[model samples]
Target: MKRHFNTTGPVIPEQHYCVDPMTRLDWEDVQYLIGAGKFFVLHAPRQTGKTSTLLTMMDVLNQSDEYQCLYINVEPAQAARDDVSAGMLTIVNNLVEGAAIRLKETRLRDWRETIWRNSGPHGAFSALLSRWAQESDKPIVLMIDEVDALVGDTLISLLRQLREGYIGRPGIPFPHSVILCGVRDVRDYRIHTKHHEIITGGSAFNVKAASLRMVGFNRAEIETLYAQHTAETGQAFEPMVFDALWEDTHGQPWLINAIGHELTWKDKTARDRSTPITLERYRAARERLIYSRSTHLAQLADKLREPRVHRIMAALLTGDENLSGIPVDDLEYVNDLGLVEIRPQIRISNRIYQEIIPRELTWVEQSSITHQQAWYLTPQRHIDMPKLLSAFQQFFRENAEAWIERFDYKEAGPQLLLQAFLQRIINGGGRINREYGLGRKRTDLFIEWPVDEEKGFYGDVQRVVLELKILRKSLETTLLEGVEQTAGYADQCGADEAYLIIFDRRLNVDWDDKIWQRQEQWQTRSIGAWGM
Candidate 1:
């Protein structure tokens, strides 16, 4: 059977086309660390193939006849919550079953119950591992996947238990090496107990040798993965699709696979080997994926609700550098979760995340808007640019205060409100593309609408550029700078209609003083201007 892109679970080598997980890491160095009895961490944002990598390592070690290695997802224990005894019992039993199947070891069957009853809840895990290490012919290697999924007291207990075993490794004969895998670094786990005590994960697991962060596939790796499909089915991806996918996803493993799945398997017509995947199909599939709100994307959207995530995102949305009240530790915490890029600029991880942020932030407002799609269309079925802006201006004047109060990102409330309003109107027949970042102090939006409603997105496309800015300078100066910027973006997008929106965030500005309805000729093209 021919294999395809995998987004649902770990990639089985014989059943899927996958990059060798070891290639993504320093294999020899990692092996050396484990051989040297180093307990360490392996973590990355969800679905970036961290589990697959650990499974690969287990296969390599067990096959080499050097270690009795096993990979078990202890995330199931997360349900135990604050019940430490239940959680630990579930985790140790999971390890025993995993070893019985993976290592063909029946030794656990010999002493499993005795160890559980005698060692007590707190000591059961340590006792079980010690016995296994002693009974096994080879050194034992243990991996706990989704380590962060365990919450509160359960997480604290697990960490301390692991630390206890680590401290007695050589003499007590516990697992030679262990790996704790999850989305956050060990240093950032703010584990809280029911006793109202907060314990840092680092102090609980201080014996850790090193923490390794897994990254997304690079452009070359993406190319190789895609080429596997071509080799298998004789179906090729157009050259442009690779570059487009890279730009849109920035090598995020789950997005890459999800997009690949949508283009190849989800669309029946695109599956035939004779029919190649085109850039248009890729774009259309991508839009579908976003709308599908697949599990991965939904989880990404949910992170916006977290306080640490909200603090960083609120600042990024408005082009602010002052993270004044946010804790310093929050930065690494967000980065470990892969919400933003750290070096180039503190911004959303990629274009998809960037687009999803505002849309997710304003879902409530978008749903509440009374604007109808058909109402904004001219008799000819094209969007009436001036009419739309006029509607927004009225909406802003009457409802901005109430709507802005609902948002955590009050500084970027105006930009988000506008996008929410635009998103509601362009629901089906068009797509709105956004560009904003740190220090930019402006939001750029491009609306791509199908002019030939019958031919749909295939025929002539209507492109309009909307540039947004906050009024910090003279009205004349802001408009002058905005018109120039709008004209430049319009030229880039080949847009015929352009608009500049300036938001005056100053205190006590009269509505009559701020409202404006007019158009200015910038160079050869006309630009509509709105003030709020």
Candidate 2:
């Protein structure tokens, strides 16, 4: 009775879940870590199924008769702040008891009580493994989940004890292999404890041998999940829907599931029959979900607002990929956050996130624009492009300043605002196609206005390519660069006309009211003012 789509973490029992791709992560390269009895760290972004992978790994290791394996979650122990060492003790005791219960060995169960009697939590953990290895004739492996939850001096003490105890291994003592799992690489930890002024966990826990990362589902996995949903519900997903979903999410597991979950559970009306999900429905569902500013979108927006994310995102939004040489902290931070993938050229990870950034940033501004329904439609039911552009000119003269301020990313707001203006006019029968990013020179927005005329006549396809430029360096320098950039983009899009709007916030000279100057056979145009 469980639906396949899950917005939260990995689905549990009764709920069908995909096998984590990272679960197949091998420890071959770091076998020395296991052999030396050193701590191992595995981490990734939240909800990327780190816990699920650990559990699966623990099960596999436990099945092997050579090693007794146990996975313990220390998240609950985090609640006890002031007495952190006591919290560690409590977590160790609980972990021992839980493992003993699972193993169902009375002697091992007694060992749990024996270990807890010791003064040190680390000593207790070591004792339990020592007893288990000696009695069962097998080495013991320990997997600690939410290891980062242990804070301050508690975290330091735990790491130090494990490092100190590494000397007693193999024949005499200590767990064979120790795995610490959390949201960040252990080497990046900056633990601040009341007792220790500033304890850099990386230096304290240099004993971490291997830092493994968990990755999300790929394209094949995405299709398989949707297919499973279709098989179960007997409701088909349109062919184009799959392509659209793949294009949007790019196999991001969370987004893939979220879209499906929203479409099936949230968007469906009571009277609507169990029908196949279409591309239109999927789009509507995504737009609605984004507009609602759900937890997923809100959290993503919050990341965008961070100073680290802000700079990198601004560069990406304005399509400034030249920061490749500039050592910006925000660039690295945003890349680490997985918002933008680091490659030969830094860019947003996928289409869905790329689409999300602009929409989430500009939704407030778009909502404020008054309805201009009359200007777009004609008596013959065809779109009036001249009327639409005239309206945009008036809008640019009036609301551009106020609207741009409302945008989350004011740098790219002007272009988005223009799109919003054009979108209102053309969205009725026409669609807008956008392409933007870093190193791409300029952001190219293509507005497709389709018009149906008489029977023999071809559909009036109006393609408007808008090129956005920022006011930095020099207008001539940027414009020369923009012209070449816009030319290439216009050629690719096969656009009939291209409008190069320079948003000059740095201009000191007064405008001559109507400054619409065209150059090079009308291939390019320049306009400057407060906004328009």
Listed in order, each prediction's TM-score against the native is 0.96, 0.75
> Which numbered prediction scores highest in lDDT against the true structure?
1
Worst 10 residues of 1 by lDDT: 314-323
- Tens digits of per-residue lDDT, candidate 2, 1-532, equal 7556777765663586465533336646445566666678877655666777777666666676656778778777777664755877767766667676765555756666657676456566556666666776666678888877777767776676667566565556667788888866676556787865777667777777777776667667777777777676677778888888887765566777788877777875611437778776787676555556677667676778865577678778887765655555455546545677777768887776776677667666556667566657777655564555556766775676777787777777767787676655554455566666776656777766554634211356766676776656576676677676666667788777666666655446443433344453224532221124
Candidate 1: count of backbone clashes, pairs at least 3 residues apart or interchain: 0
Q: Assess candidate 2 and give its TM-score to the true structure.
A: 0.75
C-alpha RMSD by candidate, in order: 1.8, 5.5
* Candidate 2 residue spans exceeding 4 A from truth: 17-38, 77-90, 93-137, 148-158, 167-172, 194-199, 230-240, 263-278, 322-333, 361-434, 446-465, 473-484, 487-498, 511-531
Clash totals for all models, in order?
0, 1
Model 1 agreement with the true structure over 422-518: per-residue lDDT tens digits: 9999978898988877777788999999988778777888899999998988999999999999999999999989999999877788998888967
Candidate 2, 139: how far from true, in Å? Answer: 2.6
Model 2, position 182, has a per-residue lDDT of 80
